[model samples]
Target: MAGSSQKDRKKVGVFVQHECPLNLLPREIWSSIAVMVASNSIEDLFNMQATCKEFLGAASSDAVYKHATMSYKPLAHFLLHLDGPERRFLDRCVEVGNVDAILRHGFVEYLRFGRRDKGMELLARASTEGNVEAGYLCAMLLMFDHEDEEEVKRGVQMMEVIRISRKLESCSKFFRGVFNDAIVLLLEMFASE
Candidate 1:
């Protein structure tokens, strides 16, 4: 046979590599494997997402986001730039009880602190959904003593505005240490009267 052209050689290489180890697996099996492999390492999980569009779709999913917190900064940037569906995905992640997803990607503390009105705007939407834990999250962010009174007041108002009972209960249960500050503040307010 004549010597293969460089283009032909490249084509052969591509054909030989066509069936990536991931693509050959069934969808459900692939999802399971991705979940197992992505268990602890956020970077590996991110690289896995780059392997292919299918993998990326699966990896960016709530199951993966919950485990890896994959959608944080970029998701925030999307919102800042007005990237709608991407922002909505972050919203869904929060709605689905994805704490890691929210803390990992959604809440940009510095941005929130600097632009209090806009941050509260997003939190207000989250709160109206009755996302009580989200309410407490805003409250807790303000609980930091270093925050100014305006920020603290916004956080307290968020707690009062959140109508979700279950999340309120969860806030009281999971974050007792943080909740204590609110109680103390209320007591102090009463005592001063």
Candidate 2:
């Protein structure tokens, strides 16, 4: 958020001037702008990345993909159904430091594909690894996956960990409302115990 990554999205212009080569832009600026541009229009960002190797580094970055998926439902939804080969490609994306990708994989496996135990295991691992979305998902799954009070308490603790974090911005504004409702539901569940 600070230091090297400040307002990177701002640098990616809607249109780079015809007179100026993109290479002329500062390296960090160029990458940040490309990622920002990717945030809004992934196709345009991919086109820019396709222009050359340097742009590829920026456009294909974990931060870029994370921002894109978190910001756009279409991208997230598309990821939910990735077939084996596509998932292998996605595995590369996550290898670049995107824990969200792993979390999403777990989510799709658990929710959409009905691989419940596998999904729950991945979610728990990801949450322990400090992925906040994973923490949120793990909490929800724990609530439903068992009747054990200890599991419920662990889930509540996970929710509390994220509830007050300054990084709650990591969850999209749309998802935040859902998460808040979830917290309330968890509270009610805890009270019933």
Candidate 3:
């Protein structure tokens, strides 16, 4: 009886390994699911990746990173102080053209670190990708800081587009606060000069 039970257990294990429903799903389906998970919370995405090799592969998809909604607080901390996995995750998101990541990184680089040119490049990329906050910041920076007349004209056009679209009215309070802070910082920067 014991020997037969052991044999049955072996068969069950084999069946479980070979017939897992999740394993049967296509990679594209897994990637789509990962994107949904990532859109909700990046922490949940990390937990999903820890589940199994297949999930890990799915969570690593560029679509997942691109669509992931990284919250502002943790992302800000990650940007100010580089940690191991968090930094890598941020880098991957930026590499995959995550708009929020690009915008925040650009803002820090431009305002905090004083790498204006690189920051502007990143901000422009994010704005072109349809990030409203990035568009606002880029417009402000170009209008206020650039010496070139054409650059100022371009910034005016961007601001005009944003105003006509009524995007400012739709902006979250958090983003509005950020815009206010940016204006103050720009004022301080010029005042100190």
Q: Estimate TM-scores for all models.
A: 0.40, 0.56, 0.72
87-188 in candidate 3: lDDT tens per residue? 677678899989988887787788768999999999999999999878888988899999999999998999889888888665445466665655666676
TM-score order, best first, reads 3, 2, 1
How does candidate 1 score on lDDT?
0.55
What lDDT does candidate 1 reach at residue 187?
70
Which residue pairs does candidate 2 place in steric collision?
12-33
Please write out the lDDT profile of model 2 over residues 48-148, one tens digit for every residue.
87888878776766666554443343324532346663465346545664565667667777866789888887778767777777877787677767699
- Residue 94 displacement in candidate 1 (angstroms): 8.7
Error of 1 at 27 (Å): 4.4
Question: How many residue pairs clash in all the candidates, one count each?
Answer: 1, 1, 0
Query: What is candidate 1's lDDT per residue for 108-168, written digit by digit as tens?
Result: 4335346655555455555455456556766766756335888778766766654344356
Better of 1 and 2 by TM-score: 2
- Model 3: how far residue 106 lies from native, Å: 1.5
